[model samples]
Every structure is written in C-alpha cells, then in structure tokens.
Target: MKFYKHAANGFKIVLERKITMHTTEETVVSFRRVSKIFNKKIMALQNFDLEVKDGEFISFLGPSGCGKSTALRMVAGLEKASEGEVQVFNEQPKEVISNTNDVAFVFQDANLLPWRNVLDNVVLPLELRGENKQESRDKAIDVLEKVGLKGHLKSYPRQLSGGMKMRVSIARALAAKPKMLLMDEPFGALDEMTRQTLQMDLLHIWEREKTTILFVTHNVYEAALLSSRIAVMTAGPGRLSALIDVDLPRPRELSIRTSNEFMKYVETASNHLENGSIGRELG
Candidate 1:
C-alpha cells in the first residue's frame, strides 16, 4: 500500500492506498473493487476501492449526481453494492450492523424528533439497546457538552438554530461513542457562516474523539478543511478520481483556507471534479 503522511499544527493524518484483499484483516473498512448498479440501467459506482484506517477523517467529494451518498449508504448497510464487497472492521457492513455498536451516521438534516428533548434525542439509540435511562442520559449529557450543547439539553429542535440542531444531531451520534462516523453533507443546509463554524467544531470533536469519519460533500473548501484526505469522485458511475492528502496544518483555522497551498489542493481537486464526466467515460 502507498501511505501518505503529513503533520499540520498538532494533527497528523496518514492516507494509504486500499489494501489488497489478502490484507483486509488490517483495515478498519475496505471497499474491494466495488460497483453498484440501479435498475440494471444506471450504474452508480464502478470498480471502486477504498480503505480507511482506525481513526482517520476522509471525505468523498463530487457533484450532486456523483453517487457519494450511495457510497456512504452502502457502508452504513442501508444499501448493498452490486458487485464486490464492503467490509467494516474486517466484517461485512450488514454483519457489523447486526452484531456491533461501532458505527453512527449524521445526515444532512438534523432528523431530530420534534417530540424529544435534546438529551432524549441523544439517548434514543442507547435506549433502544436496553441501556439504563439514567446512565444513557448521563452519557448523552456528556456528549452534548462535548458538542457545546450542554446548556441546551432540554431545548426542543424547533427552538434551536439550524446550527444548534446540527449540534444536537452530532451529539446524538457521538453519544454512541462509535468507532466510525458516516456524515453525508451534515452541514449542507446551514448558512455559510454557520457551516464554517460547525466545520471547525466538528474538527475539534474529531480530534478529541479520534473517530474514523467518512464525510461526503460537494463543497471543495469544506472537504479540504475537515478531511485528512479528500477522495475526489467521478460523476455518476462514480469511481475514485483522485485521492489527495490534505497537508494543511491542523487546528486548521479559516486562515488556512486562503493560503496558497490550500488553494493549490482545492484547485486541483476542483479540476478533477469538473472533468469527472470525461474521466468516467474514458475509464
């Protein structure tokens, strides 16, 4: 495997090429020559390969129809690849979903129940598993605090700002203390300022939690900001286009976004995205 390592600020990230099938045992998640087709007419993914380490933050970036969400859904066990396999913690995603409590997903919308308070929303997953209410409540509160929502534990989703609602959603995901986080444009609905703020906050939480995260976004800047490695995808019939290691220093504040190095990476990835159609067809 080819490994790329870089240190910025205090954060260090390593990105490695997908391991061969014989070496799957060493990876936390592996997508082996995977493909997905819809209606036998529309191909959503094609010969894709990906491997994620135990605690890395990675992003899948492309345009709206690029099948980024499909890739994530497959990993979440919500969809199955038409060809090849997807393994989580060396087990199939379906197996992981049935037997383990090691993955969580944060969707674009908060998806919080209007009837549930912040604490209750955060504890719902644990509650479903028969965990004690009081214990789960305490765990929920701790994660809420981590997400900067401690004082708003009793607040309803309607009473919160879009950003705050997203925080509640994040708190709920973290409450599970999952080994991996699957985020599908989790901040897409927020305004620019709110999105940027939450992006920073997410980095802080990811740094502390050391959770392996697979984030999907169309925003080049957002992906560059939060990912240790950005995996650019081709247009529908999506395939890995480029796997770029983000070398910007971490505790990455907004200033890094303006730096020449940052722009270089973004521009390169943007070019790949722009040319995705041609690339996919040629491949």
Candidate 2:
C-alpha cells in the first residue's frame, strides 16, 4: 500500500491505495503538469495532473466539456498535451499504443460492426494483431462469455439492445487481453435502468479481469459506484478540482448504491463538482 500526492492549482489531490490485489506496485498513468489546447485558442485542458496506480479504477468526473475525454485520449495517445507530459506505464503513450496489446480504449458508443456477428467483432482486434483465426475465435468466445454474451455470439449489432451492444464493445476490449482499459462514458447513452444494470455488470467484469481502468463519466452516482477515486474537474480549460477517495468496501453489488453509506459518498463527490464547476459554470 502506498500514498501518492499531486500538487496542482485550484485543487488538492491525494491518490489512496486501491484496495485490490495487483501484481505490480507501479504507476500505470501519470500526467505531469499537462495542458492541452485546440486551434491555439480553445483550451481543452490546463495544467492537469493525475496519477493512476496499478489495478485502480479511476473516474474523471466533470461536466460535458471539462476535458475528461481529452484526458482519457491523452492516455491512449489519441490526443497530445500542448505542454507537460502524459506517460503510460512510465513510457510514452505512443509506445504503449504502438504495441497494440498494452491498451484498449472504449468510446461512448459501442462502435461495433453492423455487418459482423458479435464473435467476429470481438475477434477483430486479435485478427488485426495476426493471431490464428481459430485461436482468435476461441479468445472471442471466452471474452463474450465473460461479459455475459455467451448465447449471443452470432448476434449482430442491430439485433442487440443498447446495453448488449456496449457489452460487445467491452468484450472486444477484453479479447485482446490488454493491460489497461480506457473507457470514455461507455454507458452514458443507455437508459437509466440499462445504465444501472450495465454499471453493476461492469463492476463484475472489473473485479474478474483486474485490468487497470480509467473511466470518464460525469454522473455522480456512477463515479461513486465504480471508481476507487473520482478526479473532479472544472470546465473551460478543464483542470482537476479535487481528487476524492471513495474508501468504500468492494466486491460491491448494485444493492450498495441504495445504501445510506453509498449515497453519502455520492453526495460528497456531488458537492465537490457542484462547488468546483457547476457553481461557477452557471455564473
């Protein structure tokens, strides 16, 4: 167990040890004084700093334009910081992403192939990596089953529900057996009932796989339900406003979300975003 502190403007940050059994005690993602700008005028991020520990689940909780996705992109090497640095496994994001098997990024939408079956979609990454067709098929089947899509491997994207498609997306990510998973509001589009259901399913997947996850979501309850720590950010030149430790017991069931203790953590995180971003954004 280790305590890591990050100093940044307008907020104090402390990364509590994740209560998970991890093989390594290394930092998975580190953002050092990172800033990102677009078109030289729009500032997507400003002096952002975060440290993601191994096997930890982190949620970037903020508004729609708070650079939550931008931060996630930086980790995946989809976007680069204008200043400072973002290191994945203490290596460049380009290096990690180039390896293909080191990281997987899941977007807001399922982004599944309409023409392909569920198993085919999940095996696409492995095929791209030049694995044997039969071997890839086996890996895809295993991941789909792990994600509760065992009976639907032959189903196409159009045949599945909103939640099911997202499940396929996750299954695809897992098929490659990546070391880290980066999710940007993967369940944000689902209906409330579906969202809650998937949240619980996702928690189960996280526990079973034990991969490092950097999830970006604005929902207070979702962050509280899923993350070990929530990094609250302010909008318009987004920056870390607070890093709140959840400190809740894990192997958690969806029932925990209804508990008073759970709501208390939700309220605390909600207040931090409220005081840091919502309160000022309205002005």
Candidate 3:
C-alpha cells in the first residue's frame, strides 16, 4: 500500500481502499445563510454559508470591507450574526465562547502585555482560569518550545522583535489547546521574510496539533499557500464569490508557491476576486 496524507486531518497512513471508505467527519463550524450588519445599516455580510470540518484549514479571502474579518468575528463569538445562524461545535457561538478551550483568536497585533515576560504572557490564560501555577507554567513552556521561544521565556514583549512577538502570541494561543483557531491577518504587519517564516511555523504546528483553523486574509497567495479551501468574497455588502479548493499536495513547503500548480490555484483565486461575482459556484 502507498502512503497517503489526509489534508483535513493531517493524518498519515498506509492503507487499502477498504479502510479508506468515506466516513463523515464532525463539523467544527457552520454558517447557514449567515448575514451580518453593523449599526443597522452597514451590510457587512449577506447570505454567506459554509461548513468547516474538523482539522481543516479554511481561509476567508477578500478585499477590505468584504466581511472576511466580520465572519471571523462571528465564529469567535465577538460579534453576532444579524441574520441566519452561526454555530461552533453544533452550538451557537455564544454557547461555546464561555469555554476557553473551545476557541482562540490571533489578531494583526501580537497584543502581548508589556509587564509580562514571554512565559507569563503565554501562561496568563491558564492562570486567569485558576489553574495550578506550576502546571500552567509547564504547559506554557511546552507551547513556547513548539514556537521556538523556549530560550527567550524571560524576555519581555518590549525586548522582542516583531516576529518574535508574534511567535509569543501564537504560543499563548496554543497553550490553551483550543479546538479551533481564528486568526485575522495575524502576520499582516510583519515584513515579508518574517511573515513567510511564521507561515511555515504555523503550518508545522497545525500538522502536529491538527487544530481546525479559520484564517482571514486579503492576500491571495497567502490564502492559496495555507488553505485547503478558500471562501472568496465580494466587495462590501459581502457575499461568497467562489469556494476554490486548493488541491496542492499536503505537508506543503514555501517552495510550493513557485510551482505551476500553486500558481494555477493563485490565478483562480485572483480571477474570482477581480470578477467579484456574488455567490459564484464553488471551484
């Protein structure tokens, strides 16, 4: 039997077709005819619908004002959907928000507290939950090592570089071991080299942890590089434009971006963005 890597679950196995017979996986997040409006007038999203499977990396890709971030906020329970339904783990977003282990968010900014050193920053969530001090620290150290920050645990946020700060931010997110990760352009502010570095680290972390990720990005190449499927959106009064499946080989590397297959997916995404068709068929 040949080896196969399941992209959604990041699983490797050698098996025959019998064992690989299709089995339905659990849905981690669902948006059914979802719509979001701000201040009763601004239509940030309309008729958006999608289902995210366990351990899938899905990206909401669109230009500014297209509700990519708005949809992400709904999943994080930071914003309410004005119409339709938003569910996480089959429960309303509000229901899961109370459980710290259910969802975690990473934003454009690292948002690390200056007073707390690297280790403490990562441990803050567990500490606030009243976990045992030593246990919380141990967990923090483990995650810090995953992000290549074990040696710098004593460094304060002020002392860290921009990329390092983001690494600490990611370690903090992983420390909680949340079921789903919602990142709103987390590397948008970093330099190109640094952003690519973090992208690789994030992929490795995802492969090992097998966490479902909902990432919002305006960059087409970034989306194609990291996502299993991309939900391309229309400009303001946002709507789903196309759902392009990036069928690039699994355990992807930065070099894949230079490949013809990768560029084909990128071009498809760009075409959808340029044409801006609302509710275009999935590609």
**Which regions of candidate 2 fall more than 4 Å away from where they truly are?**
1-24, 277-283
lDDT string, candidate 2, 1-283, tens digits: 4343432322223544444544357888999989998999999998887888888888999988989999999999999999999999889999889975989988989999999999999999899889999999999999888888999988999999999999999989989888899999999899999998889888888888889899999899999989878888987689877677776787888889888878877776776677754323223
Would you list the clashing residue pairs of candidate 1? 8-249, 8-250
Better of 1 and 3 by TM-score: 3
lDDT of 3 by residue, 1-283 (tens): 3223232233221111111111137777888888888898999999987777788888899999999999999998889999999989999887887865779999999999999999999999998889999999999999999999999999999999999999998999888899889999999999999999999999888878888889999999999999877888889888877666666776889999999878877777787789847533322
Ranking by TM-score: 2, 3, 1
Winner on lDDT between 1 and 2 is 2
Q: lDDT of model 2 at residue 38?
A: 95
Q: Give the TM-score of candidate 2.
A: 0.91
lDDT of 1 by residue, 12-124 (tens): 22335542211223568788999999999899999888888777788999988878999999999999989999988878898887777799999999999999999989999
Q: Judge candidate 3 at residue 195 and give its lDDT.
A: 96
In candidate 3, list every pair of residues with a backbone clash.
none
Score residue 263 of candidate 3 by CA lDDT: 83
Q: Which ten residues in a row have the lowest lDDT in candidate 3?
A: 13-22
